[model samples]
Target: MEMESDFYEAALFHIDRERKLYSSMPSRHYHNGYEIFYLVSGDTCYFVDDKAYQVVGGVLMIINMNEIHKLVNSSGETFERITLEFKSEFIEGIFPDNSSIDIFSSFTKGLPMIKLSGQEQGAIEKRFDTMIHEYTQQPPGYESYLKMLLFELLLFIYRKMESNPRPALNEANLVHKKIFEIVDYLNRHYDEQHTIGQISKNFYISPSYFCKTFRENTGFTFTEYLNNVRIKEARNLLTHGTDKISTIAESVGFESLTHFGRIFKEITGMSPLKYRQNYKV
Candidate 1:
């Protein structure tokens, strides 16, 4: 079963409990809202940013806006999960005088995934169940009620994390470890020029092997991932700084303004100037 709701474009809730296998790999993607992913059953490998986490039943992944991530079946079995995504403004003034606690700090600064104890999982899953019921029923004032439920869920996780911080369950295979290191390198050095042959030589892996392994682990070809990283940073610069479009293009690793404009439009659906005009704060 699956259920989804879009609350006036401010938030979304989705629940899936099907027993199925992935016929094709899902693409790596990012978005402009925070995401909460709760694994209800089965196991999978979740790639967040550069690290691949071994996500199992009762695991929760808190992803900040614009973080690159994807999920792959690790056990070749069925899985179920619930996803909630919301913009920061959705809960901006929902809590009165709650100035000290930033409920979303964990998404931005803390661990990416948390393994909950049996009891904690039951309690958190109960909240998710209630939200599902409320959304399905849509009784009077249910929208407001759903917002309250969302707040309660976030608060529960916040408190639990404050009390018992757990480390992420990272993938341990040697190949995955090396790929993650390369991913981290790419993320940090997206502004620099790179090529598959060059990166393969630097990383001490054969070019063919590097290409195959990178796509298998990250769901993106080497060039695709590099372009994504550069474009993500370009978006940040466009939205936050008053830099010339050509300068921004060169700064984010594009050799020419024409190439940068084309790729930026391909990824973001708009030219750099238009994006900056629309999204600049």
Candidate 2:
């Protein structure tokens, strides 16, 4: 659960580490790249963009770039996971030059988690192990083999997506979509100060109406939502790098380091420095 540093490309990755127990050494945060975690051991509860998913062995969780998320294993138990990270552009390198991006695009977007059967998980695990071996050894022309293995992995994911599709549509789902859209926008633009009035004007609603609806939908008032947003960003920076705490405070829309530290502790139950110490990659 520490801050792990990795540079991922378009290729597949194979991980088979064993954890003795469920340790919440690090809390929630975000990454700069896309990820696919194929759980090979115990169950883990994960938060991806604030939506929680209970993933067990034989389950696969897909995460997009810059997405906020984290993991916690409920039981006092150990587990293993195969985590693969890559860029979306890495897709063009896997697929043929003329192949359409349609199939691949969907994989990165909708319904980001899936649970696989025992047999299905075993098959993918075997291939992933073989792919990892070849990638690490790098025999002559191994790139060709590596690329082929990655293509097979993609094909498997696409087929699984086809088998168990998400529900069609509902009014509740529409409101959920709207809420997530606004949240995503705020996450991307938290540096600029914006009031309920501004957001309501943009969303074509009255200020009071917008505040009430947003709070009802997201379970947090506008100011609370904004504070949490900044706190999440601040934690990411503190644990991920050596930037000055003050600089991170301002980067996350906090006007002062003291306020950032106070709120961070209120949410994370620890100060920024302590959080950083627990997550040195």
Candidate 3:
């Protein structure tokens, strides 16, 4: 099924649990809402943004909105799983509102791709079973019950896998909040001009200081990080069979063909022609 925005607000959700029932083909695309999938049975290759996961029973995946990724099973096998989708605002509403907030952090940003341990998996699944019951049965007041159940399940996962029992508001951490803001903005608008001076200027900081701290925090210089984003977009378009390497380069915001070609070759260690040629095989 083609997943869409707000598949989570009262959520036009779906679950599948049968041989060849819920498996789908690979198409590298990004969504506009959060999604969680539990591989309840069988094993298959699950592709996320720029990586692959050997997903089997009890593994959970959180596919956040706007994260360029895809699902694939090159082995021509079937897998069983249930997928949950929700809106960002809905999840954000779960945060506490405090006026004294200072920093700029978001649970939505820098989310490390996650996997559940064997014990943790079983524990979360037990709660998921309850979620399935509430959702399927849809008894009286089931709406609130369903939301409440989902909330608890999420909290349970976070508690088990995350160091924090509950994530505080972004304002809780000043430096991280600022960095996250910059990263979020960059991700959303990397196709535009995003010099360190421009970003630092908007944030009311000196360019030199911003560059130094950003490198320290994210472990990459500003240019390197921007190219990383561009390259990821390029890979997505290429994997999805978009034609014209020149078009992909422009779409990803490189201003010049020569510069784009050089950067692509530098990072990927081959020309775009070579890159796309391999995918044709």
Candidate 4:
């Protein structure tokens, strides 16, 4: 979706599983803002950047700008979630010195998902309920009240993270941790050429095992995942920058402009220039 300034400075959503039977698999997407995703009930698999995480109710998934992510139902049972999306500027505008709030430190450090206990979940949910009510009511000074509620919720989560260290946010298997390290490296170095052999050697694993583990964990082959990351970056530049198509291609690690053009069109259904023109705000 195109970024529109007036669309929503900040917003919240409550999605229930009963309403998803006809909903297609959402296209994996990223935005210019941050997202706080809380699973209210049921089970789901969340794919963030490159690793797939199995998350249960009461887990909070944090997403920063340019991180491609999506959710898929992992169980047939009912599911529900509350999502809050906001621009960094919106928060800074409210509290001039908002750097003291470190709710997103873990997210920036690559630990995006955190599991909360029953009591903690209830406390956070109550604040969200209040915000939703105020939002719907649109009472005088509702915005100020909503901001205060959000700040309190953020502080609560921050304290929880500090007090309870090493929550079981993902699988504890050694292989899972190893693969996550590689995925993290790929995300940080997507502009450089990477090969399975080279990555395996760097991680001191055999190429065969690296290939198998990466696919099993991310649901995408190494080459496919790398290309997806590169293309996502290309899309970001196309929509928000003045870079030339060739420059964007090379900067994102595509050696050939023809190959970049083909893949870009296949993934986004439009040429680079066309996409930039169509989506530029």
TM-score of each: 0.55, 0.50, 0.46, 0.52
In candidate 1, the residue pairs with backbone N, CA or C atoms under 3 Å apart (3 or more residues apart, or in different chains) clash, namely: none
Candidate 3 TM-score over all chains jointly: 0.46
lDDT-best of 1 and 2: 1
Q: After superposition, how far is residue 19 of candidate 4 from its true place, in Å?
A: 6.0
Model 3 lDDT, full chain set: 0.59
Best-matching candidate per TM-score: 1
Name the weakest run of 10 consecutive residues (lDDT summed) in model 3. Answer: 165-174
Residue 264's lDDT within candidate 1 is 82
How far off is model 1, as Cα RMSD? 18.1
Worst 10 residues of 2 by lDDT: 167-176
Per-residue lDDT tens digits for candidate 3, residues 67-151, read 6555554334455567776663543444466324311222254442344443454456556667777778887877666666666
The C-alpha stretches of model 2 lying farther than 4 A from their native spots are 1-25, 167-281
Every candidate's lDDT: 0.72, 0.63, 0.59, 0.67
Clashing pairs in model 3, backbone N/Cα/C closer than 3 A: 104-177, 105-177
Could you give candidate 2's per-residue lDDT for residues 1-281 as a string of tens digits? 56543333333334333444554333655555567777665445666654665454456887776666677665445566777666555445555573653556545555777655434654676687786678678899776776677767777777777765662211122243344456556756777787887887777777777776665444356776676656655665887778888888888888878988888777666788887796545
lDDT string for model 1 (168-275, tens) is 333333336557667767766788999998999898999998887776655456886777667767876988998899999999899999999998887666788988
Query: How many collisions between residues are there in candidate 2?
Result: 0
